[model samples]
Target: MSPNVKSNLRVASASGSVTDRRHAFADLAKNEDVHFIVGDWMSEYNMTTRGGGKVDSNGGSEEFETSFTEAFLPALPYLESKNIKVAVNAGASDTKKLYDLVVREIRARELNLNVAWVGGDEIFDVVKKAAADGSDFRSLTTGKLLSEWECDPIYAQCYLGGFGIAEAFKRGANIVLCGRVADASPTIGCAAYYFGWKREEFDKLAHAFVAGHFIECSTYVTGGNFSGFKSLPSPALSLGFPIVEMEASGEFEVTMQQDRDGIVTVETCKAQLLYEIQGPYYYNSDVVAILDKIKIKQVGTNRVRVTNVGSIKPPPTTKVGLTAKGGFQAEAHYFVCGLDIEEKAAMLESQVRVALDETKYHCLKFRVNGRCPEDPYTQDAATVDVRIFAQSRDESALSINNFFRPVTDTIMQSYPGATFAVDARQAIAKPYYEYWVTLLPQSSVKHVCYIPSKGLEISIPPPTDTQDFLYEQETYETNAPIDLTALNPTTRAPLGNVVHARSGDKGSDCNVGFFVRNADEWDWLRSLLTVEKVRTLLGGDDTGKPIFRFELPNIWAVHFLLKDHLDRGVASSSTYDVLGKNLAEYLRSKWVDIPNKFLDRGRI
Candidate 1:
């Protein structure tokens, strides 16, 4: 253990996103003896729609997460009584508003709780001026210049680190709200402040960063988004929020409430560790976490211990997301029932294509989802959905009459057993935002901590000792490649029968990570699940997209990153699986030859 810390610091997760259950903070405050309650409220897509972001064009009432405000207010007295602090990025855009509102509430309640906020995340005007000054705004993904982008930029926000939050806590603030500090930074700030950790404590800091990430999604580490859903009781029940007990030694234990229906295991922890990461190097403004040598294991019931998380200095540049008006989109679904599913879908698509002015729209697509079995027992099972999805920059081109009716009008003239799903909700074109993530020099960010009690806005200095390296994954080869011919009898089965996976979207790219329970299967898994295999499993979605694959042998897992998978960001995506949440399930469903012996061992 680091000599500076005397005991373990307990940090509990309160909320995952803006829409996550509000009872989390109160529940944790009433039940757990935690020093800090940290949670994240923002997703990349959330910014595109919420206040002070893309919504600037459209009038927004409050311009912050009001639901989270309600959740935090009720827990204030309990938190103050227990001397528990809160560190969160719930200040989606306007931290000043959030700070004022929170401070008002605290004073109104006659509570002595102090309030602080971190800002300088908003850099819309700065970026615009820099861009106009001939500074290259190149795309991190395609390496194309920002000038080439069809969409005009409106808002730009840099991802801040935890230093500001740490400063807030150090300055005697009970609550630290942030705008766009990286999601896990709240946990990093809490652990750092409690341990009195310095900037040079990369190893310890990296572990806290990962620990924050594990429980950042609240119940994710507690088997909420876990692949072994069926293995736990009450799989569909609302899970208890996660709490991480951190030590100065850079090790932490993840666990949830005993009464709630959620399980904390090694598998669940691994699942969250692999989620939404672009590569092995997790870049943060404070410290870049290296997951290559990380270790996780179930130490006790409802407890999983994570250790040995490696780290390097912060990347000189951090992610900066810029959002712009992408335009409008609307879709109408037509359910074709019973026989001739393919023929009916083809006929509908052909008619819809001719009826709609494809040239006027940015993307006009007809997608056919699912299929009717040779003889489906029920009507629901026998139906297939044919969707006419439309997107256009011009509002007039995507009006209900232009976009919706063109597809719905063709229903009577085309296909049999045609019942279309179109209503006032789906008929109108809703505006969407295009999001792009790129790297900006950390020096450019004006990140600061505002301590209301002290009336100070202390600017945080970017790390001086930083490394410059391409964000990449290193392949792990712990054992010799398995010879398929010598393996157990092969059977055609869903890959999920043995391998379990977790998949999520990071910007336009998708990350899918697969793991196994048995140690022996680790070698086979790394050797079997390659980039080519991932591409093949993805089918049309692959489309020669660049894929980065790596192995996490310590966790018995192989991870694949499919780039440019989502058609732009989720806010403007035309794909049905906009968030790529189902990528793992879709990949697992693909028939693959698996060893009978492993199958006999039972599926994940």
Candidate 2:
């Protein structure tokens, strides 16, 4: 390990979607100087869905792994020529399988790439034994025990850190495949291995950790899913993925391919920094990243430097995402247009209820989307989608054709201009599952790195200390209220006009973080957006739900976590905004008073 020479580790995110993004892989592979290329292809929902079939039987499926291999095969020659190392957690439930496939492909092509697989993230047997031994496996969202779970889990896997990936790289493995390491583990692992960052180098590790967090979702920090996407100079469709250039001092600059579309500015970086994080302290298996004191600056045309990252102690336990076959769900959508949209939806609901047996389903919901225009100027303006969703434990009762037949049958006699959104036959019942997110003792997980070429296996241990590093909530004094009457003139505009926000979901809960561009606007933002004010912004959505507000004075940001906001998370949620990606935009659309002085500064 060379500590004297500062390493400029350039890592790029190749894939970010749950499914295959072969184009992204091809795009990142074009950069010959990239040392590490990472891809994130797993999510809790997809894990359960992909693992539903029999393991070793005729019905067994490895479609997820197969899709990745097919998409990634195109970049093999380029990667080998450039000697670029690849790290990805595309192996949702089967890392070994993916490793074998890659090795086979390399041998078939006569390539010299060394492949490795990191496992031990899967803890199904451990969890099963614990359950039999009367372990509660309490729910993180609701404090209820796992004993109350309606069905047995499909599988249980813990979130491992970057050490295992680092070990693989240390063992001379050029391409490392992982099962369920933290999303940023590949980037962190590569950086750690290249710079020889020890466990004790918490500050340096924390900076890499934050950098990993920023680019884990690929183009998210590059204006792909940004709230101010409309104002961005580049078109969102062809946006470039993020690349991080890490310095030994722990500071890093986030940039993207020059030929690709997208801009990396302070606003975009700050927006992604606040994405999905709970509070000032962000926890991972490797270290607790204290992000309250971080700073962002646009140093170049498309480069933003993130510095001053601090760290606290690591956690004693790692989080385990448990998925169980909850039940079967079937849904159908009917488009309603013209006058009395609400009346048309209610009438359709009444007719469907009389036709279908309600007792056969365990859960049922009817949701109406969009609104009828007072004076229609376009066909879309007068249209609203009415969806009927039904879930049941008995598969036969929730059969697609049988469950949705009632809705389809009524189309002939329903309200005027009523029709199905798509082919009604496409409404098929499929298995939906509940995601139980809980923590497991770090010592229980055995992380191993295996290099197939040398047949070498290395064991990665957890932190020596077992003390919990759970962050103690800090008490923040609220800023004094601003005298709105003192301002000369105020314009009633959307909060998003001056305030930029980023929001995402954490299982059943969701967090939305708001930040300002200027320091003077920070005071007004802080004073204007109190807990009460935020609750008002949520409108009826906050009914009976708990909302906690946090302030990060150093970064001039205020974050709020809405509990149980997402019905049952992404997979099973009946809500249209499954991942809560639109929650910030929804809040931003709400009108609020903005000071004329702040607006005059060209912050529109």
Candidate 3:
């Protein structure tokens, strides 16, 4: 049977985590009209940690293969009954192994499911050759060349697009597995395949791109991990994964399973849209999506329609993630409570400095968490955790027993109310990785889809319109501040009291975007929140880092990007919020002047 080109394409995301979400996948299986199901089982942290290990001959990791078996085998019967095609990037480091596993499971059940695998995103050899040829693989975060890196990369993988998966579906495959493709690529591929969208349909592709981005994180657009959780429906535990009803004209409606415990509204859709986006131009390997003019409207109960998405030319190069063994890291935490907490913390720090030599470690940090209240109601209120962490290339320097003995020796002579947070001996040293993100030419990547039954292999090439690799930094002039005296009365409150924000990490940098509910608030937001204002809000966290601010008029949002703020990315960063997930909440807690007029209009 030929696939329909004019019908609405219904694509749903089943799982978002690296581990199995049996309930979510079950929810997907129960749906009747879902044309396709997608899952994202890989994250940047997962790539750096689990993806660094050795690969078997079939190019699969034991960890991901186990996860795939546990998550998918149970749902296979249901998926086959529904005749739903599956597209997932769960293969991670090993697509072939996953493909083989799926085929074996289907054959044992006497099912006729056609499984395909997409490969060639792995580019360790290409990166090696480029580095050897004196190619300056400059770091996207630090601007340092690859040659300057101290550690050798264990693996390097470029992000592939969805066209290859689309090709696999075109060749009559029921399941398509991929490695290291963009998270949204699965939805993009499914939509393109169903709608017969041409490669040159930039506008349609842009719409699918945004739709894919929204649902890519599974329940994100359906109220999971949302800031306004209180505003959502009750029983958020059984939140449903997202589904997009994509039209042939590039418009889509975001919805979720009616039986689930989540709601889809304009607020949730807007929040997910702002998550992890850098600026107006969101660059994907296939298309550069323009987000400044995006529009979201609540069309019905638990349904939001997104439209007006734009796109520019696709970049010639895709981002390559390189993970290398950094060194061993170890840390221990101590608690100081009751009166004179600051004095006690200082005394403990002094004792540690005198007991241990700082020169033995490559990186050392003494961080204090929680503030000592001036007038405490309880001991816990006045307690603060002091953590000491050290990392080094030398294994002995980070050893649990040797490195902590000096700190333990001071317990007898330590300050008042000093105590270890937990058993100090439980702290163990473990190897970490340095994430080096750079760009690789798209042409250097070989994208191929393999269909075992048909004994076919298809090659997917880069788009002909691909341009040369270019990095253009967007610059915006600071808009003049609104005259508070000239306007109506105002009240001093936390910026979040009147604004909605979402934040995420991009390598070592963090991006925080603030959106307003109405035009009046947007005027105030655009005028009030500048790069300088953002730095002020960040306070000591800013550390004089380079900050860039951009304005999106259509969404009434302001976005700020702070560079080198997350230390050395998630894997090697010593900070508690390594992924920068809490950065927006922290900013929302900072007080800002809000115009009384906007607040009176129920903008908050």
Candidate 4:
């Protein structure tokens, strides 16, 4: 995709309130030029709930769609008036219900409406059908249904892709609804149909994919939860919706609601572009897109247009998103200070362990961190906290209350500084469980077809080699090696760069990391920074375990078990998580335009 494409058409971008998302449709209906309606809905967790827990269904429940429905339902009348096509992935968990509701609305209005529902990505149906077919579920990954990882037979469904909607469009569905389709697919399907783009034109498809990444999260492009968010003209009302005007050549101009609140500055767009998304190669489904060297044109107020986008061959397969159970554990922490810290801490821990004996829980665990008086980080800190966190499904609460409750008693009867902290009256208990699952790429699974649009006979070439794929531009350098000296020896960490970026709450914990292009690049970087070099330089026993891991081929880089690394854990615990989080911010700040500066900088 290139930034030079010209799109003179006037598109309607609407915003009102959640209750009037449908009424907002009046803007579309009133505008004769409006051809399509796109809705944004989803969150970082992809789950609707504000907090975490075992939910009723795989993708939370349909009830979670309440906000979306309140906003989307009223749009039905306007959609009928314009004969415009509507596409949204708001189906979420009970997508079928949403789909049925929309279809019913269209029909009851005597509207000539076509609706298609996209589901099956939830994996619930796939697991069930496999069971009915007596096929192993793992075969989805191995191309043979080998059931290596057992799934809740009732919960798994085949991962669905966007191509199915092309088929829906072909079948005369003006409205498309889906569950768990790749985010980029929605934008790609619209562009592919509008421009008569073929699949072999992987470059344009990839460019559209990047465009989707920018605008898919709705308010994200308009400064919602953005880094360094500033005073907005009207955050309390008139929230914006993103708009992408694409030309036949696959280039697009990204903008937000015209005449809406807030300034659509390049900085706002760039900040959104740089949010959690690591760069050079932006990715989704199996497609890896190169965004470096792509041009951004500020052609109009509130319009930061894009063009000259590039694409690469899709991976040989798709990654499945499945959730499964791991195990269970619990943790509780307390603050303590006073003299003979280590000794008092030991006594406190012993007392807690004895409490566990009084209350039988499946498994109990404990740890104590002692503070020295001379430690610079802690002034006059001659203290020891006997933190007791226990793990077990049954009777775990009994152990925590029994063990840590006596700390107050100790302050009055035996320990010093015990009175310094807040009341130890309440014992905080956090329940835990393991969530582990892997994805199987769509290429590995068998599917019936890739549907085309109505009145459009689209021909997608069979999978081909690199030389045959069509891309708008090429700018990626071959993967480079990582420098080892940049990391700390004892901690095996790279000294993070100083950054001026901040997102979310000041103290809120975040999971942030940069994503490279592919597994090949990751492996190359790992080999370049050999364990011997890292261990020798950092002085830490290099088990060579990467604190960071990449979900390969999909090209997502991950830093797991990071809560503690960012200083959200026990005090005096090196505060590495804090450093790691800062390191992520530093990388983002330093490399906004220079694609691989981190690789070139030799050290952190």
Candidate 5:
């Protein structure tokens, strides 16, 4: 560590994703009193390709996230004027390409900023060669081999650690562009560089990782997408960006400006911490965070102190994501209004199945999205959509004549009040990507940091120390059978009346995390909310899917991880909630018997 360690470092999270506020970086540099800024632009939901492949809303051209150009171009001079350091993974598929774009702009502006780009994220060709050598590429979620996948793999991008970013900062690079680095890596890199922490400094590195995780989503830690969003006086859309005031001891505080919207409290911090995490052990390429013992408390208005985060060495394997064409999918909706909704949906599904010759396609399904009320006032309320969806490898099966004609031709034959919620023009088959999450050895990554001004490329090797991570989650149960009658003064109501939840997708797996407001409710939560109870709450939709339960006692939370729940994942999911974001709300809506005493305390 440095002799004169940085007393305090102020770091801000600029943009959460491609769709986040375009003026975030500029606004921060011009208005905020921060020394460093980081942004994460890559997401599993959006698939970007290298070279002349995909160039659309999903991703940017030149093999990187071009959407960042407009957002960043105006912020460059502001960065020069304010002298703030930046690190972002906006170089989606191509790091060098985006690096050149930034360098050209810097040259034109005559700014003193030294630019750098990180490499080793793109490993498509390497994996392809390894697959040919009879190496196993089994999925982390399904345990299915890559050979078993029906489609050909097009791209593979590995998530790198923060060491490369640290090296870039050490090499005098004022601005760094990265490809597919982990979301929290930016914060970790900034803190490591500022505080002179080594890669083996597991405790400090892990603490930085937690801070990175909290603020990486920009407004997430600032009340955006919160279950208690209505409690905030300001609208959820106008949330202030997050800031982490980190100290040399690895202690940090999460807060945002009060002038803007959003609140930074213990609950919002806990909510963001639990988002997208599968278990108590949160992994990164550099370090693994032991989250069960972490502490978060409100120190002042819009400020929360976080401490006691535990850590261990990184795992030998890192997460690798590959995108492949999963054939074509299309959907058409027929509205069944008024009475006989079930019979109408059933009749239409049976008619369409035969008409479309569903046997020719990979999979065809008829699903009733919403229910028609028994006695409704409006036609919309009395309507339910019977969706006819199909996926097929053979393009002919999804063609307009074959796929569209079958559903449209059945209008006259369908039951009463049959109409199309989806039009004919939108029913044409569109290509979707299937994202696969798998583990790759860290040794496979030849991580490097390139500083263009200095003409230097520093090799950042993989960590030597690692622990064999246990994928299993912690389990807690009653030692003996207890009397349900003792606490039996209960009332049947929606679980949301007493609990709050946040759910998100992780490839084929879905995590629905539920929490309470205080420790009093925590006792009732951990006892009553079990895997079996959660399965029942899912209403048999998960079927035979395995649901794993775990608890975060410090946060008064219980998490349920459902394996293979999203089928092929968000990009190619057949379900209506493609990202599985609504799973939490769905679980919250399920009826649960709450004790009258606990109910009297006030709802979450």
Candidate 6:
């Protein structure tokens, strides 16, 4: 009845504050079929008040409770009167409070309403209990103890699956609030419960997952960042949250509320859908849905029919990203001018160092940018901006700021043609954060799986051992075992260019690599990365000698580990063109038939 009540459903996401709720409520009131009013009230910054800290790897804190109390207080009357349900994850840092508030709010009003509260991975108590029960909190990626990282943890929550909310819906909760659930859960829950989709029916879940991805960031999908977005019918009033019309047969159309100010055009929504998604492997706890096969059909100005969604078995583990305490860092900026010129600027900077040597700093570093003698002669003469950085533990890092005042005066008086190109200022340097990649052993985390309306809760079996999971992958029907021998490496004469590939700072724990390609031959390049090449690239030999290769999805990638090949320098820098000249020369000599176009298109 719910899925069929209308061909499409539109949910509205707006501020939980009373003032903002009025704007959304007014829009919802006009649309009789708009099924849900959604709110996002829990972000990391807001959760600290409710005894939740920035460390909650799940998005935001249980601060959803505060948002709930504020928005529901004003919108309840309008929501109930309009027969529209509300779904939100405003329970920021506190799940228990969030659960209690919604339960009590509905019951206090004497309404037997379906208000569901989804719990998250905020398991401080669970971890304590497990520890008391002699359990270990070892890092999955590194076999290190949790205590070794010195993380200032305020919260630790597991990312919840969408199936849990469907269970809550079965219990008749009209509204749903989740803790750190994936942004797509609401869409998945609505589709599975409303349409009665099953486990074997993965296509429907994939459809719902993608629909959620399109609208998860709210207005972004509605025309916010659309490259070709034209004038909206009503820019001020038309933008709203999204909805999916999923059916038993696994077909769905994404649309928003009608009769609003503006339009929800196909081009706009498609742009948002594709924005920020890294590639074909769309991941979640229980499903790894591929986005390549999905088709978007523009039926009208504001609607797109989504079809041909393909689904695959999810990875056994989910990656958790926690921002932890990693000491303090600070930076100071100063502008050194060259009047009689570049040589003068360098001398002035050297004089300031003599002044700094008198002071005690735990650690210090200096970098000179803009108008140095070694710099290219693009500028008329030479003027340089020198930035000095100092870092230490919390207390010591504060000392570096003191140097700013004295250094400013010394440069103006002592150095020739020395004027402050930019005034010297001091600022706090945030910590160099690190990420540790660890698998949540299936034994530790549980997956409670279910189908629509079945009331049967089936726990997905744990994956076989890690080695088995890695080695036993059966190639999907759409993909075949690629024949590597038929493929020929494109060789070219060395173009005398060098490219340097290095790991992103955060990639200290994870393996970050890159490959080369010629700019024009980017299309159809990914097909060249066969299973054999992937295995070879990702594989390790007994000697611990690193072997590297790349698969071309769209770009002809010559992937290799940064540590292995980049001890001296990477083939390229993050800014691809920096080494273009060097790379052209290198590829010409060592490579053959290399897809020139594939390698060229990945220039960032």
Candidate with best TM-score: 1
What lDDT tens digits, residue by residue, belong to model 3 across residues 480-564?
7676566567788888777888888888888888887777666678877888788888897877967777777777888887777
Residue-level lDDT of model 5, residues 1-604, one tens digit each, is 2222657988999888878988888888888988789998888875433421543333444667777887888888888888899999998877788899899988999988888999998787778878887797878778788888877777888889998998888878889899889999999999999998887889998999999999988998898878877777656568899999998877899999548888999889988887888787889999999887889999999999999899988999888988887778888888888877788888888888778776777878788888877679888898787777888887778898989887888888778777876557558888777788887888888899998678798999998899865555665542343455567799999899888888888888888888898777677777788777887888858667777777777888888788889877877778888878889888888898888887897766
Candidate 1, residues 434-458, lDDT tens digits: the string is: 8887778888888889996898989
Alpha carbon lDDT of each predicted model: 0.84, 0.81, 0.82, 0.47, 0.83, 0.48
Q: RMSD to native for every prediction?
A: 2.0, 2.4, 2.2, 10.0, 2.4, 10.1
Error of 6 at 367 (Å): 8.3
Report the poorest 10 consecutive residues by lDDT, candidate 5. 48-57
Compute the lDDT of residue 567 as modeled in candidate 6.
Answer: 15
User: What value of lDDT does candidate 1 attain over all alpha carbons?
Assistant: 0.84
Give the alpha carbon lDDT tens digit for every residue of 1-604 in model 4.
1112344322333321122344454554454455566555533233312112325354454533556666666676667666667666666556667766776766777767667676555554554454567744332112224355432322333334456555566556777776555656677666655555665777777777767666665566666544435445646365566677766666777776656565555545554444433335554553567655565556887787767666777654443434433223334454556546666666555655543553444445445554665544554465454545443445344443554454334445444444424553334443332212234435334332222223333332223333221211222222454553443232223323211122221111232433333333344334332323323433421233322222211332322111112221111112223223343443343322121434453332
Using lDDT, give the best candidate's number.
1
TM-score computed on alpha carbons, candidate 4? 0.60
Compared with the true structure, model 2 gives a TM-score of 0.94
- Model 3 vs. true fold: TM: 0.95
Model 4 CA deviation exceeding 4 Å by range: 1-34, 43-64, 107-112, 124-154, 157-159, 231-238, 276-279, 326-437, 441-604
State which candidate, 2 or 5, has the greater TM-score.
Answer: 5
Where does candidate 3 stray beyond 4 Å? 1-4, 55-65, 374-377, 477-481, 598-604
Provide backbone clash counts, one per model.
0, 0, 1, 36, 0, 70
Q: Residue 6 of candidate 5: its Cα lDDT?
A: 50
What C-alpha root-mean-square deviation, in Å, does candidate 6 show against the real structure?
A: 10.1
Clashing pairs in 2: none
lDDT: worst 10-residue window of model 6 = 566-575
Where is model 4 poorest over a 10-residue stretch in terms of lDDT? 498-507
Error of 4 at 66 (Å): 3.2
